[model samples]
Target: MTMRSRLTTNRLFLSPFTLDDVDELHAILADPRTNTIGSGPFTAIAQTEKWIRNRMAAERDHGLRWYAVRQKATDVLIGNCGLFRGRADAEIGYLIHRPWQGRGFASEAVAAVLDECRSAGIGPVWAIIRPHNTFSIRIAERAGLRLARIESDERGPLHYFVTSRANT
Candidate 1:
């Protein structure tokens, strides 16, 4: 079995992704409505499997990657959230299933991951949200990230929010 920290909050538990979670992961990623501006609602199960495999590899190599978030009472997988090594720092990201959106789950997951980052001695994580993704912007802010700037990419403008430790 894969070894990882199991993080808990009042309402949810966070565990690292494993191959066993592909089905749940696929269910969450299959809805196109969940695919916001710059990411995916995976086109196929195989694609989702590839994503899980990649995350597994990231855990093996870097000891950090997205996690599976589930409801504490039912253990039903509801989302994934975490950080990855970015060009300049750790980049935070998350996704909650369509049914779970707007319930504060994403913010809870993000806050847990931020605590993990602090414990791991990682600093200055950043969240890149597409402009108009107000829900995500709110989650990031509530999780203690502050907007630093907006930058345009091939996909258009993205709002960059960094941890309180990062300078504006």
Candidate 2:
């Protein structure tokens, strides 16, 4: 789907990231809690800008993009969620700001994005989560993705959760 298309739920609106979103998105990315399982929080605003630029390019060149997740009421960006080209299939990923976690915002955003993927005929979405990331594992399971297998890379064990698909 095009970047103009937005995915919505009762509490969130998922829209494409724009250059203007750098400030707010950087706030979330700068928080250590949001990057516990990944490369770690961004240390500078330039990194956040580069990230937005790269995501925009991915949308333009590869039809893969991350949507900025915002609270519908206040229009504040709280996180991001989207489908990305994965090793085996399209993968879903999301990050909710620390203040917004535990309130079901991540789960809602993930469900909305998964619905969008399914509507676009994308199947067998995967959530390759670090084994120790119980928060994301629970979110994946809540979004109807089940643990398919566990694999290891240089980062260590990863739990590969896949959507319900016959081939998987």
Candidate 3:
């Protein structure tokens, strides 16, 4: 929430995180599908708010950029999507609300974010995809990212992607 987002798209808009968005954030991150790759869920909405606030504080403390993804038509937030801990290269991460999944929203917003980053001179946007997350892997490939590695973690193997700014 330190800086405003300059990115927007036809179906979605990306803006800096706001503490007021706790409810919507909870709606998305608490879903089973969303949590499939996250830390866990918050039984209390207040806890989600705490987490969001903590993320903002952490971003400020660590000098990172975070953005909130919202539906343009409804002005309803779908989830958080951003280049985590920014650099000339960044890690692309997104999670769609369960009801909104499988509708290309993730691909659309992610593509939009990628284009935004490239235009801002952030080259070679990167993402670490969970090995079993075929959906995200396909989405990244469709957006022109090339798999760079199959990494091992405590969970298991995961794929890493890096997009070419020249092709963007």
Candidate 4:
């Protein structure tokens, strides 16, 4: 029963994540292809749940929001998108299931999340994509997040992108 002013697109909805979404998320984690593009333990559902749960518990935004994506027609869970409190900025990230990839779903989900960030009064929402993750870069472009920086993470330095009100 969580609610927010941000509205994901009508064809699909990006609403706050709940514990109830465990099963859908489990499937996403269990698939190697999805994890490879999105990054995770492809064959382990429990591990995925733990990872998401820990993210849910993050006080980064003083516990602001995380969204689980669902289709409008069938309520089929597709993926997730969220705004996290980074060291000096707010960032958005998303992952689409293998079945949903290359279908323009990720782009749509990001649009929904950026709209959410706007409603939340966050400026210049950022995203960090692995160099090879072109799908994410496409979504970021659709959402108006431009390439801002290219720095490394624990995994490696990445192309850090940003979407701001000016760009939108």
Candidate 5:
């Protein structure tokens, strides 16, 4: 297994996306609720598979890996969390399955991703969220990121949060 597949937290394990995980990822991302904060819901399995392939390529080429977060006890894939090559800088992103929400899984997974970013010497990780996504904003804050600014776009307003420079 690759190093990207070995990240672990107290109750979770995080691994890089693989083609074999397409079905689980599709199940997680297919929900309209999951995408309401950012991209729209994925309607096809091909889109999820392509996304997984892109994540692998990002890790191979850009050193950015979106990890699949799983429960350590049952070893079930629960969601994905990690940094992606964003338009400006490395963006810290995460998604937990609908069934996994409200159980602190998102925060734990995000905390792990932030730890990985800091360990990798990547400073000032960014997290973009919709202004109304208060839950995610709280998760980002708890993960050691501070609100940087809010910007408006065609779609709507977005809240941009960044890790404190002291973390560098």
Candidate 6:
């Protein structure tokens, strides 16, 4: 199924990423608080550029793309949310800038994406979150993904959350 390029919520908007987003996206990704659970913060603009290019290619080749999350009123980018092909099912993930955290933006964006997933007939979506990221874990649970197991990879332990058949 073809996913829409834009999604909206009461206070936020989600659109596909473009190279033009590099500067703002780089700032967000470079923030230590935002990258605490993942690889360390990005150190260069080229990294962010490459990131956008890769996601754009993924959208073209795999039908999976990351959305640039922005505030509707201000039209300022604050984070991102998207789905990725996973080992068993599509996986969902999101990140909100520290300045925008605790304001429910991440949760809102995730819920909107989950609704999109449902409409697209993508079921049993997974959320692979670092065990220490309690904030993300809470968002995953609130989005109706229950913990199925904990798995480890090169990145260490990760909590695997999946949408229930009934929920999806």
Residue 47 lDDT in model 5?
94
TM-score of each: 0.90, 0.92, 0.84, 0.83, 0.93, 0.94
lDDT, candidates in the order shown: 0.81, 0.85, 0.74, 0.72, 0.83, 0.88
Candidate 3 lDDT over residue span 85-132, tens digit each: 532345778878877788888888888777776656665678888878
lDDT of 2 at 41: 94
Regions more than 4 Å wrong, model 1:
1-4, 37-39, 166-168
List, in order, the clash count of every candidate structure.
0, 0, 0, 3, 0, 0
Off by over 4 Å in 2: 1-4, 166-168
Q: Which numbered prediction scores highest in TM-score against the true structure? A: 6
After superposition, the stretches of candidate 3 with alpha carbons farther than 4 Å from their true spots are 1-4, 57-64, 86-89, 165-168
What residue pairs clash in candidate 5, if any at all?
none
By lDDT, the best candidate is: 6
116: Cα error in model 4, Å = 1.4
Ranking by TM-score: 6, 5, 2, 1, 3, 4
| Residue pairs that clash (backbone atoms under 3 angstroms), model 6 | none
Residue pairs with backbone overlap in model 3: none
Question: Model 1: what TM-score?
Answer: 0.90
lDDT of 3: 0.74
Which ten residues in a row are the worst by lDDT in model 1? 1-10
Q: C-alpha displacement of 127 in model 2, angstroms? A: 0.4
